[model samples]
Target: GPPRGRELEVARLVRQLARERIHNVVFTAADVHYAAAHYYDPTRAQFRDFEPFWEFVAGPIHAGTSAPLPMDNTFGPQVVFSKGAPPGQTLSPLAGLQFFGQLDVDSRSRTLTVQLKDASGQAIYRHTLQARRA
Candidate 1:
């Protein structure tokens, strides 16, 4: 679901349901090279939220996908789980991680755990936050 593309339709559907059911969805490495997306749920009468998946195939190359360190980076909010964004900027670095890892969603509690890791599957950091109601 490349934020606005028809990429990985099946995976997008699975991730979409995970968000709706309030379950924990892991950032599994699918077939996509690098993928991110903004999901618009028709049921909620508005765009629900976004879920970004990092494949780890080329994670250590981009700034958004780079390893997050306490000193060598500027940390910000997890943008992959947002509903939508400003006009013409759905694919910005602020929208999704340029690197990759896993996105965990708790539908019952509306919680999301963003786990970032290096290319070798080493844990780097996590950002947990409550999801906004639609």
Candidate 2:
């Protein structure tokens, strides 16, 4: 999670991007010791001046796994998918809670595909996004 005031900064940036007509902006992050997919939509956000976007989170390929944290609603983020240890529990890497993510971009179609995989390299969740034309 970001420190205090960071979300406001992000909201400001989002509004600026919308003013510039930027679209299909995606964000990826790790280090939460879990895997999840979130979708942010201005229509459902507290700050509603930006377009919808996607944020992918994954990590801890070889470390202990922590439970998913509560999401902030400043950006109106909805959890599309999430996998993590049970509440109040931590799983070691050997417990098979490890995960990794893959992203593929196609220039011809201007699309982005995101996949979250387990230790065995099997995809557990997948999503594809078609870029908006400028």
lDDT of each: 0.41, 0.88
Ten consecutive residues with minimal summed lDDT in candidate 2?
A: 1-10
Q: 56, model 1: CA deviation in Å?
A: 13
In model 2, the runs with Cα more than 4 Å from the true position are: 1-4
For candidate 2, the clash count comes to 0
- Please report the candidate that would top lDDT against the real structure: 2
Cα TM-score of candidate 1: 0.29
Tell me how far the alpha carbon of residue 118 in candidate 1 is from the true structure, in angstroms, after superposition: 1.1
* TM-score leader: 2
Report the poorest 10 consecutive residues by lDDT, candidate 1: 68-77
Q: What ranges in model 1 sit over 4 Å off?
A: 1-58, 61-99
> Which digits, one per residue and each the tens of the lDDT, describe model 1 over residues 40-86?
23232222243422222224234332222221111112324322224
- Counting clashing residue pairs in each candidate, in order, gives 8, 0
lDDT of 2 by residue, 1-134 (tens): 33247676887888898999998899998869999999997777777888888989888868999899887777889999999999989998988989999999999989999999998999999999999987
TM-score versus the correct structure, for each prediction: 0.29, 0.91
